[model samples]
Target chain A: MKHIKGIFAVIAIVMLSAFTTVSSGYKIGDIATDFKLKSSDGTSVSLSDYKDAKGFIVIFTCNTCPYSVAYEDRIVALDKKYKGKGYPVIAIMPNNPDVQPQDNMEAMIQRAKSKGFTFPYLMDEGQKISPQYGATKTPEVYVLQKTSKGNQVKYIGAIDDNYQDASAVKSKYVENAVDALLSGQQIKEPQTRAIGCSIKL
Target chain B: MELYFYTMRIVCLLLLILTASCKNESRQNEKAVDLDYNEDFSTVPLEIYDFEGLKPFLKTNTDKTYVVNFWATWCAPCIKELPYFEQLNAAYSDKNVEVILVSLDFPKKYDSHLKPFIKKNNLKSKVVALDDNDSNTWIPAINPDWSGAIPATLIFNKEKRQFYEKTFTYEELETEIKQFLN
Candidate 1:
């Protein structure tokens, strides 16, 4: 009876520890897992494909998310501004069609064309890729830097400090990270809380 | 003396049993109260169709720090990080931290799924439905680079607004909120 009670106590402790560990999610310094997703143009784009680039921006966004839509121009601008600088932005639509049909491929194609997106707006079908990047929301920015070890995530957070009044913006997080990487400097703010629509699992 | 000892043991056992039963009863009562609260709030569907209507609901009080969280009923990461927002709201109750939960659940499932989920979680933040249909106009308004995703959260303090598109642990969330609050 004592042995049984001891086993039960041990099991409870193990379960509690397991729960605590599972609750604490991703962090900076984690290597970004590669994924192959189809772009709006139906071409497959993978993170590994951009291996030659100095850094990569993996943004989990979708067609229907207003927040994602809001960042459309900025994302395009980021792609245009940084792609040449070797920090190309890769946009991924992580919404599930079963829940949000409007976010499907047809809408994605239209949205990309309307926005004149220079970056690859990849469709994360089966919703498999977003979680791998620990992407929780649309417009979530993951800045990756290639080191000797591999593609290490440098900064993960918001684009800029202001969405409403851009003129009074204090911090340009995305730009700063890119600039730091370009100048061969370390990112000061390594991680940030991403704000946007929760990715439909 | 043996008889007295037996009586003492019996009395102790009865006290233990009585206390155990009382604790169980209190737990059951607490669960019942929670169920009643859930029932009261569960029926109200997270309104997800009125984008224009929601604009007015969005507190334009730029003086306060607005923490808007975009979550859906289905996202696991959203579920994981929601408690931190609740805690943040509670901690910063004295401050201008207004924690808003924007449900991104589909319009059709708002009533059946979203409301119950929110209620079950006992979310303490202000809940709203962002009913914007067209992503083009709305997304740019929110942020230019956003590729619509869920579990997104925005922290706005009139002069400064921060957009995050990633899941956060409590420490990270607190750090961001503290930055805004400070």
Candidate 2:
């Protein structure tokens, strides 16, 4: 009886440890809650600050993701192209520092400087802000438009069609969504499947 | 009678020790197996290429429903839904469904990271390295609307294609596959 009890105790310990590692999944059509983060230049920024703005482009990105790096120029271009039109871009780094230390604030600043990123690249400290947005991948794009209901998610998906070969791209998703919103028309494909490196939880 | 009791007690203690040793050895073996399969492709350089090579694989097979899942070693949601895909593969083995795991891991990590990960997971489905470097060309061809996110899955029959950008449970994946099958 004592031996059986001891064995059961060890098994229970292992099962309990396993439960602590499990993570909850994100869903679609979820509202992106507001979050505060430190910018690459050490300034604090918040999603609520952009509430009165025309629209917002919340891009979950990082320093080391090749897919995110590929869209660096495009992200910069999108900010420049749309900021005047009232849709400023906000880049958020969503990776856990314990797993991806390069995504920390100091490295974020260096990457932004080297890549000439004009927009604010903020660090999602404690990694709480991203999961709320249902952002699971780096380079995931979320287009938010102010509605009577609140800040509604207009579009979510890949930045474009091609990441490795630019010449063969058949569609420009981010640009198209922004264009549709700017034209005061509803975006036909508001949500799209984005492919990139998974954010470390 | 005292001597007999003492001998029996020693025998029981020896048996207990033997059983414990065997359990420890098996646990170690399991750990080694797991270690052998875990691949970390975070630092590898990406292989850059066009989509021309994937043309043959892109064509839909008439009778079978193809499930193309795009994932990487680093994505959390991708890892979360991996078991569902594996379960789908197991459940639909008799059906005309093929689950393809396309690793978007950097090309440099192919041998060391991606391959080991596939093997460690005991993945039974086909795995391919998407060597495309530029997202501009590849994303549009796959779908004009995709904003490159990991944990994305594409289900295609010759006549229809369905794409999902969120993580799935086994039931959800199986339901989508069934729809394609029907």
Candidate 3:
């Protein structure tokens, strides 16, 4: 009876852990945690860096993914449009250089410089931050609204409906979410999805 | 004569899948931008689809177990695991296990890049492209858990269905698919 009970307990524990591990990342209205990561410009950046900010456009993107590259210009435009409106774009490279050397910090610096990015392109060293937000792909967006509670994950997903061509885009999920925050209105689309390269660990 | 008929039937089924992928004009035009693709793939009959067109493949009401793997030419990890899916298809096709390689390569690369990669690899499994731009809609429709990342997979039969958002080894895939087998 003791041996049977011991076996059952171990099985239950294993099954419980297996179930918990899959249900990670943030959901809508969830209070997001903050992190201080190194930026391409050699300065440390965090969500709290912007004191007068209303919210943030947190994008988990990398230099290597074509999808990320395709959205690079649009991302820059987003920063230009919203930074003055109290919402700034904070780009994070979540891929490990070991897996994809193109995503190394030096390349990140080069990419940001060449693109004339007006945002902080930070590297998520040790990959501690992406998992917390549950970002699975490059160019994944999390629009976080700063509140009395903490930074709230307001909207999550793609930059727009048309990733192939910026001109053809109909819906810009990140922009819409941030705009909603600025207007003191509820975000219509709290979450969305877009095809992106799997984050290289 | 029986063996010949069986082979013919298999060939016809393959043909049907190819033809079913013919363009859905209305939906295609809405998402079509100014980008152009090379029509150099005269030999490669790879069917390109929006998520709406690709939906039927995911919900096949068949007796055979189906393994649909989402991959792309640019994704290194997806390419690394392509052979495993091919191997699974070869090893289990006779056992009523079918593998479908769903390529999520960009629409611009469908003809220029994906076709060459398929030919170079000499892929045996049925290959198709999901060219859907409205990913936010279809991504969750395929699986609410899927974060719209490539190399995700779906294995199903009439009795059970499973979706994986992780890389798979051949043995690991075999082990998972075996549970649905007799």
Candidate 4:
């Protein structure tokens, strides 16, 4: 009876730890895991493909999220401004199409075309990518800096201080992080928070 | 006679100010209740709240445990898990649990989309609209772990506070409530 109780306790502890690892995902300074996902252009995209990229602005955004829609133009603008500067914006659609039918591949392609996106808008089908980065919401960003070992996440959070209005945005978070890396300066603010639609699991 | 005249003028001035203040107070009270009283019973009262307005609703001084669920009309998972919240509210009415549905629906959609959705669903729990334009500040203030995800729930009383960023089944929600209740 005592041995059975000990076995149960051990099982419970292991289960609890596993659950925690799954739930509480990546934090600041953690190395981001690479993923190969289908882009809206029908090509598979991965961070490793960007050979010249000093870093990547990996944004998990979708067509259906109001917050994502609000930031779409800004995302495009960011990619245009920074792609040549060695940091390219890679937008990922992290929502499940079954839960959000409007966020499917067809819709993603349409949205990208409509918005004139310069970035590769990837679709994270089955949501295999966002979880590793700890992305819980649409328009969430993980600014990764390429190091000798791997890509270490320098910052994580919103694109800017304002998601409602692009013109009204006072702070551009992704821009700041990328600029800091380009200039070999420390990122003053490593993280920010925003309200966005939860990535449909 | 002069003193009497002066006193009468002062009294008249005071009375006028008093009446004006009273009228303003009543108008404000009427405006506050108008949404609830004027609307149909099926249509839930939806008030826009900033972080300041939303703060008190999170951590309450009262004994009632508030199960505040952040949701939107467009969010499918939120819609899926809403019935569970409604059921919990219904079942635990006698208990100290209070359910509040905070809708993060767009301001423009309040009339065209959200109001109608609430009416169509006949959401029984207290519903409010959070219209904070700057999400960067309030998301972390609400809970450090929250990524500003919808279908997220904050269950709290005076003693304990728990924030969940994942969707809930009816049973899962009940178990969470039971854990907090204990």
Top DockQ: which candidate number? 3
Sort all candidates by DockQ, best to worst. 3, 4, 2, 1
**Could you give candidate 3's per-residue lDDT for residues A1-201 as a string of tens digits?**
555555556556554554544436677889988999999999999888789998899989989888999999999999999999989999999987876778899999999999998999999899888877888888899999899999999998899998889998999888888888999998999988888887776
TM-score, chain B only, every model?
0.71, 0.71, 0.76, 0.75
How much DockQ does model 4 earn?
Answer: 0.19
Interface RMSD, model 3, angstroms: 17.2
Per-residue lDDT of candidate 1, residues A116-162 (tens digit)? 99999888889877766766566788888887777788887778765
Candidate 1: where is the Cα deviation over 4 Å? A1-25, B1-182
lDDT of 1 by residue, B1-182 (tens): 55555655655544433322221100000000121233444456454545566665444655788888877665555676778889988988788788888876656556666677676777778888765544434554665434355556778876777777667777988898888866
Candidate 2 lDDT by residue in tens digits, A85-173: 88899999988766776777789989999999888999888888776675666888888876666667878777777665556667788
lDDT of each: 0.69, 0.70, 0.82, 0.79
Candidate 2 residue-wise lDDT at A20:
55
Stretches > 4 Å off in candidate 4: A1-20, B1-45
True contacts kept of each: 0.14, 0.30, 0.48, 0.48
lDDT of model 2 at residue B74? 56
Decide which is better by DockQ, 2 or 4: 4
DockQ, all models: 0.08, 0.13, 0.22, 0.19
- Per-model TM-score versus the true fold: 0.52, 0.56, 0.84, 0.80
Report clash pairs, candidate 3: none
Alpha-carbon deviation at A63 in model 2, angstroms:
0.8
